[model samples]
Target: MIEISGKKILVTGGDGFIGSHLVEQLVDAGAIVTALSQYNSFNNWGWLEHTACLEKINIVSGDIRDPHFCRVITKDQDIIFHLAALIAIPYSYIAPQSYVETNITGTLNICQAALENGCDRIIHTSTSEVYGSAQYVPIDEKHPLQPQSPYSASKIGADAIAMSYYNSFGLPLTIVRPFNTYGPRQSARAVIPTIITQIASGRKQIDLGDTSPTRDFTYVSDTCNGFTRIAQSLNTIGKTINLGSNFEISVHDVFHLVAKLMQADVELFTDPVRIRPVRSEVVRLWSNNSLVKSLTGFEPVVSFEEGLQQTIDWFLQPHQLTRYKPGIYNV
Candidate 1:
């Protein structure tokens, strides 16, 4: 097992929901961490600004689209967790080129940088969206790639680029494909956050798209843990592993569950604008997590109900709730 302590780690997109949580956990485990936030005039670090360990790690603001910049920051790092990407499905419909440049080209840049720097490992992030509507139950690592949305198409390309580096250039890399993950600090663009924020913001009627599509939702902490475990295992090198709960739940069910947990009586109404094109909608996703478990002996500890309640508790906080504008369709 590779010890996490004292290892220099670089997390691209460390300012994002999962990346910020991963940065915090790596710091707790004694890793020297550098978090990359997207460059902006205001110099904000996104969710990383709210973390307790913010003072302990270095924060770099830059875009992964630039190869020169990628090389500069990846230097001296022992491992690179490439979590940066353009992930919104709705936004991708309007601006697919942005997704390609950031997700596909950006991954190519990271892989090249890691190779030049001789990093020990690279855990490239992948989403379950690449699987599209599952053809069978318990989608495994070998599940066929079907890109129903532009965002998923870009990710499929990104995963291929990362894997090609491992296969052709011998760069030690693992693709950590996580199913839908939810928790505190998640963007309101996601369903769980949208539901929680709307109710917390005093909306009696919740606007939603098609809610019948089911997903295998893993909590953010478990997803981060999976990333670390994948890094520690030598067997995971050059492998594509999945991080998921192997459980499935639909958006309609999740809405009712969150409403019950928050003690709010709400009505859900389908908003035409929120609906995806019929052919683009991914109707089902249930993960087969046997690979990650066999490789690292990792199992998700948090139950779906428990995670949902925790998410509800966080969004209920007035200070946190104020940050989200539930009235606006977030995409």
Candidate 2:
């Protein structure tokens, strides 16, 4: 692997929660970073609006679903971090076709463009949700892919698309599958933000979906590090790696932790509208990230309590808190 200091890097979905943080890290590491912000008439840069390194990056506004746009942004880049997708689970149920077009077709565009442009490496992002409920604790790369929702199904297809390019065309590629990531700038659509935003809004009764499900949460910074670490390792090429803290916590416990940290007395209320269909809900997920450890010596350094406190502090900020509508279910 070459030095990232002067390398050209393109980050699709660069304005999203994890993508924004990753782009900042790339810039800080001295890489020439180009960020893809979804085109909007307002020209807002999503989460990148609050990024300190905004002036240091080249921001392009375009949809990933556009192959011509993907090809245009993908050219003259040493590396591409493909993270664009329709990620909300509930939204996936309502509009799976959109997920397929964005996640699956978008990945196809990126991979094809990377191959044509001679990009050295493509770091494709994956989610732990691809494994659905834990058939076994600490899910590994070899674990069965149980697409419990359209979102996961779309991701599964995307991962396959990326890997196929590597297998057939020998395009350098690696899939970095990070578990549930939470931190500052994460949209209210995610559960962690939902919980934090609701509590911060002075809601006496927290509205949540299924509380029984557990997830492996990784801090955004740690996940970004995982991507960079994986990208730099040649051995990770043409492979799928998982990024996660081995620890797991239930959604109810998450609410409890946040409420305790906020010093707010709140009762949890289950909202029927928020719940997923019986078969769609992933009951549990704990990642076996030993593969990434062996390959890149990467492990999640942030503890759950510490990360949650940091996230809560971020959402509690006046400017940040105002962006979220805590009174409504974001999904």
Candidate 3:
């Protein structure tokens, strides 16, 4: 097992929801961390700007699509957590090419850079969406890959690119596929945030897409813990593992639960604009996380209700709540 403390670590997409949280955990673990936020003219670092440990680590603004930039940032890093990807399923419908560029080619850039730099470990993020609607319940790592949407297809391609690096070049790489991870700082594009934000914004009617689909929701911290644990274990190298709570809940159920926890008397309605294309929708996702548990002895500690309540508490904060425009259907 590798010690994270005092190691030079680089987190691509550290400015995002999961990436920001992982950055905090890495800092707390004593790693000398460098976080990469997508280059923007405004110099905004996304959610990382609000992180408590923001000042503790180095923040570089650049696009992972640029191989030179990825190479520059990856140099001298002991571990690379590649979380940067174009992940919104809805957006992928409108811009499939962007997903390919960022998710597929961007992953190529990171893996190539990591290989050349000789990084000790590379943790590539994957999503359950790659498993599509799940031909079987409790989907295991061996579950067949079904690209239901351009987003999932790009992720599938990205996962393959990362794994190929391991297979062909012997790069120390692990694919950590996480189920639906939601919590504070999640974008309103996601269901949980959409529900909580709309209700918190005082809307009586909440808008959502299909509610019948079920997902295995792992809290943000648990997912981050899985990433860190997988990175530490040499046994996990070249392996693809699922990080999930091993519990599944429907979107409708999640909406009602969040409404109850937030003490909001709200009704949910299907917004036409929010629904995915019929064939592109992934109707079910339940994860079998035995591999991660057996390898790292890590199990998600947060209960669904408990995690929802905590998320609600965070969103209720005026400073945080104001950041969201709940009335708009975030595509």
Candidate 4:
């Protein structure tokens, strides 16, 4: 237990999937958390709106692309967790420029703001997508990056920009790359959410893309802990550490296991749109998380089957299942 009591922290993208979970944990850890959810006319906080802790924390609505707002928010903060970005891979194909602007340019703003505010630490959230396909099994921090998709290319750019801040300005920034995080409050755009929603909606035929690719899926809570662990430890400054379960499973195997858990015999149908371009597809991804374990003693607490069960139960709720379009493919 790292003591974060009375520490002022800023969490960008605090409305989204993993970000919301981080906010919940930060609050429990006794931090004065300021959560920045993307601004909307509907005033929707996304997943954070449902959190019981929302009433106790400061929720700011703004876009990280605005450098002025970023600078203003960083003032008086002890730590910054930058996570705002466009993450849907399929949409990135159509809006590559948007991905660059949000992921790269937005990161630049956060880094600059953190520097100006003299923030003690800035934990930049990165993705394993920056490592397109596995050149070798159990990819480590030294793995070569080959961006196989537009989304991945943008992330690579973002990671470089973040590291530059550390190298040039001596900013105390750490990049935490989490692999394939899945859990409750996740959007239907992800594979786990897609499968769970389809089954919850009583779909007899589930739509899917290529099932050959493998991924290392970490639960949301574990991923969140990695961020806090890096923040609390001074040894992690200027380091790019991984937060993963160090386990791999194919899409086909995951779908089969999920079906068994639900006791539903569903058939999978191939969708051309759901499939990545032939060369752009990453065939496998497995994490080598020993670096993080050595630095922070961080390990995933939730087992795959246990996490899957929790996600399934949450999506099974009538209101949550209704939010997803089971019959249509989500981009």
Candidate 2: where are CA atoms >4 Å away? none
Worst 10 residues of 4 by lDDT: 1-10
RMSD of each: 0.5, 0.8, 0.7, 1.0
lDDT per prediction?
0.96, 0.92, 0.94, 0.91
lDDT pick, better of 3 and 4? 3
Clashes of each: 0, 0, 0, 0
Off by over 4 Å in 1: none
Model 4 agreement with the true structure over 1-331: per-residue lDDT tens digits: 3357789999999999999999999999899999999989999998888898988789999998899999999999998999889999999999899999999999999999999999988899889988988999899999999988899999999999999999999999999999999999998889999898888888898989999899999988888988898899988999998889999999999999999999998998878889999988889999999999999899899999999999999889888888778777878
Taking the tens digit of each residue's C-alpha lDDT, what string does model 1 give over 1-331? 9999999999999999999999999999999999999999999999999999999999999999999999999999999999999999999999999999999999999999999999998999999999999999899988899999999999999999999999999999999999999999999999999999999988999999999999999999999999999999999999998899999999999999999998999999999999999999999999999999999999999999999999999988999999999999989
lDDT of 4 at 321: 82
Ten-residue stretch with the least lDDT total in model 2: 1-10
lDDT of 3 at 253: 94
**lDDT (C-alpha) at residue 252 in model 2:** 92
Candidate with maximal lDDT? 1
TM-score of each: 0.99, 0.99, 0.99, 0.98
Error of 4 at 188 (Å): 0.5
Query: What stretches of model 4 exceed 4 Å from their correct place?
Result: none
Which runs of model 3 end up more than 4 angstroms from their true locations?
A: none
